[model samples]
Target: MAIESVVVRQRVEDLDAAVPFYEKLTGSTASRFAFAGVDLAGVGPFLLFAGSDEAVQRVAGVAATLVAADLDAAVEAATAAGAEVVMPVQPTPNGRRAVLRHPHGGVFEYVGPS
Candidate 1:
């Protein structure tokens, strides 16, 4: 068996504020969608949404994780694009990784084999 990909979904309070930051961070434009009264933006493996606080709370602290080819470069790019470091890049028992918060509030982790 094989797993294809993962999509981490987050709910935001403001869709407008979320889109630009994600677009910049991912270096990809958001493809918008409407699902269950929420506005969504497909940012790489993340599905960022804007809706009620109650719904948003459901996924709090859950982050989208990606395996990067160049962990340092990825962290630099994310920072340059406006993401704040949630956890500084460091080596773990498993590998090297960094956690960042998108300007819109969604968190993500970038990991790479070292």
Candidate 2:
């Protein structure tokens, strides 16, 4: 499966405040969405998140969320490559997601709509 893109997560107090800056920077409109009570949007490679402390903490310090056409393959490959699955594949509102810790100690989330 080909990796689609890496989306950087950033917590913000206000989605309105974040959108304008990211829009100018990416030169693209943000598509709004919600996941587990958290406000989510994408501008270029950035995934802006705004919500409560608990909601924001879920994705905080994630470093990045990797998107791929085939999340199953991605998870399988990660396991084969020696990464431990910290969060098993699970259904989300839009798709599936999982967290992994690489052999080198870096952690990241992989997500996609299967």
User: How high is the CA lDDT of each candidate model?
Assistant: 0.71, 0.89
Return the TM-score for each candidate structure: 0.48, 0.89
**lDDT of candidate model 1 versus the reference:** 0.71
Per-residue lDDT of 100 in model 2: 90
Question: Can you tell me which runs of candidate 1 are displaced by over 4 Å?
Answer: 1-60
lDDT of 2 at 2: 66
**Clashes by residue pair, model 1:** none
The TM-score leader among the candidates is: 2
Which residue window of length 10 is worst by lDDT in model 2?
54-63
Clashes of each: 0, 0
The total of clashing pairs for model 1 equals 0
Q: Return the lDDT, model 2, position 19.
A: 96
